[model samples]
Target chain A: MFRLILVAALACVITSKDVLAQEVRITPDTASFSVEVNGKLITIERNQDTNHKITNEFTKTSRPCPPFCIHPISAAPGVTTVGELEVIDFIETSVAKGNGLLIDSRLPEWFAKGTIPGAVNVPFATLEPSNPYRDQILQALGGVQSGAGWSFAAARDLTLFCNGPWCDQSPRAIRNLVDAGYPADKIRYYRGGMQLWLLLGLTVESPNA
Target chain B: MYRIVVLIAGFLIAVSGMLFLQGGQRDPADFALAEDIVIEDVAQMSARTSQAPATDLSGLTSAVRASLSPETVAAPEEADDMAAMTSGVLAGLGAPAPAPGGDDAMQQATAAVLASLNGATAPTNPAPQSLEAIISQSMQAGESDAYIDALLNEAVTSGSVQVPEALMTVDGRVDTRTLIAAIVQQSMGSADAAEIQAIAAEANAGTTPRAPAVQEVAGERLYTVEQGDSLAYIALIFYKDSGQFERIFEANRDVIASPDKIRVGQQLRIPG
Candidate 1:
């Protein structure tokens, strides 16, 4: 009887199937990926432009990969995409409350031209597109800083903007974030670029000042 | 006796074989990474310690360089301490806490807002436990509409709760808990009710300047794209993504056509 039971158990174990096949998903699912030599990671969205090249090159700014490193990524179905207006409102309120940074998805030169005040610029080109640099960028952006002085961490309520609604800059940058494995809800894109700001008569400054 | 021993041995052999097969089929790659885990914890330590502002690397460039070389990553003990320092710094600078008396004020203010709109306590379903826990968990999950009815029910079930007819607004369209939270947080530490009134007036008016404070942005470089500037390639040069490039492109689109097509030296606006 015991032998029969053991055989039955083995058969059940072999036949009971629930696991599913995995696929290669990009880090910043919405952007492109470039791997750097130092095992650093860098992600670039589709819109921003700059001429300053330091090191490394990639086919596209983002791409999907079979989840590597030490862990697995799982997701439940039926997640919803939150709207841009809600994110903008949250950022506006958060900024008023002194919460986090609103990153401008422009090049250093463009950043010099004009941008929302207190925003940081990280042109996606200079990062490694692999296991490490993705985290490094987060650390560098006052996202996750260290030392006796002040540090920053990127995991916050961030609202990103570039040109305008038809403009793909902010969306591309947001894609980088999404691909970098950040949840879609955490990122907010402002589709209107400087045009909307000018139209609204908010504020503008020349890059040379 | 031999037959019995053979049977026992066969059982053990079969179990061991099964275990081996199971282990073979189990791929370690199929694991989930909760946000906090790092890929190379030791490598992370070396990177942080090297970047530490206090570390003296001036006179000891060679030593610093050697330590940075992949082979000599920080020792286990040193890495642990450095990692701790890194985490401490992160925690210290991350998520600011809600202001003093903020929760109560938020509740009251939301109640007031709801009263103005609804005339009764905005109905909520009875939640399993606490509102605070639910909210916190929602924030962690990025959002949660789960058990909202329960939460409302619980709030209504609490005794002596004043339910005014005026609080019940037409269409049941009430202000959200988030709006009240924002309002109450802004009112914290105020010395005057008049100031609170004024602030509320501004909030209600919605004409308050929504943009962040302006800063100096002059003398920044200009990179106008001539026709055929691929967003990906441009992002590589800028160390940002093509999305950021579009920010530049759209900001200056009046001078250029599509982000895909731009003339050289278009005086593209670059933020300072």
Candidate 2:
């Protein structure tokens, strides 16, 4: 009787797996993932509909080039440029573990439009030396202040992304971070950013939500 | 017969008066309008931030302009008047336009304006969690009317939001046309002149601007290893990334035979 029951359970599991195959996934090996954002559980997944075409403002192929110029794969020396899968891994491993941050380094209005799940709004402008709260932000990022300079003994690994390859906000942010003595090796740039993230039908979340 | 003659005479006199009124002197009081003229420059600067009726007016003007062909375009004077009206409507918004310049300049201007707009609340919050935030979030999530209605309903039921009776129809439905104005007014927190005055106010009631105070400590840096100190910790203190411990280990080969072995109170030179 126990053998018969085991066989039946195995059949049931197989049928369920077959049903799940019809849905979209983060990758072939991964279906959906959840991240803890601001103490809330947000599930990040691709749109299930295969026919889902992007109709938003991000669909425009042409943007005026002076500001929206395409950026290279490399952000700067020692800063590792990453893709969407790595970003997911970073969010899960570092951000979920509280050892890292995914910085959406765009202006607040742009950030308000939409962003990656588990990301925090740290506008690129605020990271500059001009902003009065720059040190406070540094401190919040685990920089210890002494008379000499900031000690990043416990600094979080930050992965920054903006509005994709055409967007320079993240690159500008990476430069500023390096200028402020943030380790380039610790900083990762998601060059694909929002544009590619959306193009691939990956999830986009709002900070307010 | 006398009545007919009188009516004809009255008609002729009225025609003469109409012609006279076109080019003759008139009372200035006849053309009186509101004294507190909202500056078009202020309106233009505010631009997209306002949800006032003026925004719709401006939107309509632009829409009209967009829909019309150049051949069918209105007179230049009429177009100018429309532009002026659009500018006037724009003043009701809270945004401050940046000086015209290159792309970087424009982006910086946007950043500056956003920073100032956000300053109305706690300095720590990057964006205001107002009705606009709700709509923005909704747009990001799903811009369907049903979704927005559900969101607004949730907000109302949660008691964090209060829609005025004027904003509601007899059946308690939100009036979509006036809702934009309500959102803007809620975010602004007060009437028009008060907002303009607040912006015009001599930049007080904010933190005094200060230059970047980061003193350059870039000379040949040195550190005294404390108890339980490792090359990694020292590297972290100096370079902000513990992965760079190798740089230190390579530099201090004479003092320490191995990268792992660092005794307490050992002096080491940290490279800049």
Candidate 3:
């Protein structure tokens, strides 16, 4: 009888541990709350609709070339390509602290649809070297303009993202910023962008919503 | 007794092994349920709707017409004559009289005139143009390449135009300026030279000339780690052989720390 009891106890312990290991948990330990952006308290969460499937502008898989193509991982020698976690870290650490900017390098329409929390929309084209407003934009990003010259000593560290890995808007923006003399090391690339961001169950806020 | 003990041990081992196997086997139903919950939560959070906005054709026509200067609008006598001509055309086509003073009627009349000028039927299904089509249409409208460039630059800066995947190249890549140029070329094929010149002159009059192109130096190539990716696999993609994973490891030594360990979303440099 004692031997049988011992065997049963052992089985029970093993089974309990196995069950514990297999149980799935979905809720994040972090507190869910709204973040303030542009003087508005914006609540960030997944779409409440149970039928929400990803049908954003980023849904398309293909585009024409010579303009649209897969981007190289790094925009410049010092520019680091980061993932979602690093982007979140930057947001919590640098952006929240006002030491950096999380830029959504998509056009306004995409920004209106939804974007990462605390990101400011700056379309990639505005940073192009040929753009007449490029200098003004650089200045707004904290570049110091002098007579026919500029300095980026006070420029905020920028983390830029677009639709996702397949999207080139952010990459193009990064390249333009780099070419326009934005410090490469100060710019980080969030390659996962909105696609991966949503896939990972991170919070997104829509200005229109 | 020895035989009995051995048998018991074997039985225990088999039971434990079965438990372990069961533990590892995830129930698909459970996963589906969890996914459903996630979807439900997201849906509750965003309250997003799938219905597209209704197209206001009359509003669009009015906006277009309102953009025209007062000088551009015809005198009352000329307007009356044009109205008579429009009515004659409509009568000839056996169309009914338009509703008196209704915006819809005015919109129809304006649309008819615009259609006749373009030698096309009345517009139907007035969906907004995609960015690609808009850029193409701008080109066709005799906008100068410089003007279009400036317009695109302004639109991007203002966040009015988002990135369109249709502009991506076949290989799933995009060069922003190159894409703009291609769009212009595609649209310019049917554009009038005089209109293009006029728009170009107007755009040039207001804007500083574009600076000369600077020689570009190629920079380091990068690769983002993906799910199911290994150093060897990445090396094979870039080098066409797996043996050079060490080169990748060497380039990304700071971030990688070890070749055996890499995570999705980590960016690694591909050695030139």
Candidate 4:
């Protein structure tokens, strides 16, 4: 009886070890959760289509050059380059807390197509220094007006992205914001953008939908 | 008592033997081996660490890069050429010709404009109308619809006007006016200011008097949804009044379910 018990115990230990060895989890812990955007809670999950393929504007291989060339990893000094996971974490921590913004810097058409969950559309052209609406937008982004200048004391952290690495709209937007006196440290860049986000099988939400 | 002691001793020996064997089988990849189960635990830990955040950015970048096709990989260079070509075509349409000597792109653009104009006028007038003469005549004539069409057809036929594949409709036709506008907008600095103004005036002349506010090009006046576009915003762009978004919503009722929602890549009719 004692020998039989020992054999059974040994068998139990080996089975548990084999079971653990076969399990492989690749997604982040927060991936299974939901995120709140524009007063609605959106569940984050990859597109469930078993035969899913990227079929958006991002599938295009080229665009006008000079103005729309591939952007460098870093937009400017002090602005950190981040990927999808970091972007998700920021959405959870900063955006959900209302202390930061996830900015989709593409034009309205691109924004209308689809975007990463939790991102708000802010076209790069609308934020140009010469645009009459620039000051209004800056103020809305929590910039405070001081005497003869603007202060970013109350400004929320901003993470900007556009189509992907090959897109310059977000880089231009980031540079424009930094030039407009928004602090560089307060800005983070998701260099991967929509292309990488989709590639990694992350969720995308359309504003219209 | 002796039997119980022997059993305990046997268990110790078996446990020690297992530990000893595991120590000999230590994986070279492991940094430490505090427990017999450390190998599996370390693998899980390494995988968890990879999924944690930021540490494997290079790996992710490479994966994304690998997944992208070679066409996408070679896009930047092709984009520059396409942009130059687009600028050249727009310059040909009505914008001012680039300076006598500029970059290769500008030079090619100027040549393309000359070639297109030469082709358009070659059969009718032995001395081809200079780009300046054509623009001046079109503006003075105030007959932009026919004039622009003739010019675009000439350019398209000559293969000088290479519309990017993205701009092509399902039927493989391109929107000449939008193509012209995109090129003009993109090639702002390269084109002549007065010429651009004249072209804009002529283009707007045809659309402003139309009751439906549609540019009277050959087909339906359609606008593709761009990033950041809303119904109101698109209305503001075409109709100059955000309040007229309902007009667009009404026009696109078949495809559009909600006035507030518009998808990118959706073709919205700019009802006349």
Best by lDDT: 2
Write the residue-wise lDDT of candidate 3 on A1-209 in tens digits.
Answer: 45864785678677767655443222344334355543556444444333345765455543322233467788667999998668767876777667788888775445666888877767664564634445656766788987777788899899999877766678878888887788898999988888888875567877445
Q: Rank the candidates by TM-score, best first.
A: 2, 4, 3, 1
Interface RMSD of each: 21.0, 31.5, 18.9, 18.3
Error of 1 at B157 (Å): 82
Residue lDDT tens for model 2, A69-175: 68999898899999999999999899888788888887555666799987877767666564545677777777888886878878889999988998777888898
In model 4, how large is the Cα lDDT of residue B162? 55
Error of 1 at B231 (Å): 50
Share of native interface contacts recovered by each model: 0.00, 0.00, 0.02, 0.00
Per-candidate DockQ vs. reference: 0.01, 0.01, 0.02, 0.03
Error of 1 at B126 (Å): 61
Full ranking by lDDT: 2, 4, 3, 1
- Candidate 2 positional error at A183, Å: 0.6
Model 4: CA > 4 A from native: A1-31, A48-51, A62-64, B1-272
Model 3 Cα lDDT, one tens digit per residue, B1-272: 77767766776776677676774354678789889988887885465345343235554334334322243244332332234333322332235434232233334334433342232433532432456754654544344455555665556556666644322222222223334433333356544433333332343345322321222336867676654345654544455444567888888889875665676677777877
Residue A203 in model 4: lDDT: 79
Error of 1 at B76 (Å): 48
Can you tell me the CAPRI class of model 2? incorrect
In candidate 1 the C-alpha lDDT for residue B264 amounts to 40
lDDT of 3 at B189: 54
True contacts kept of 2: 0.00
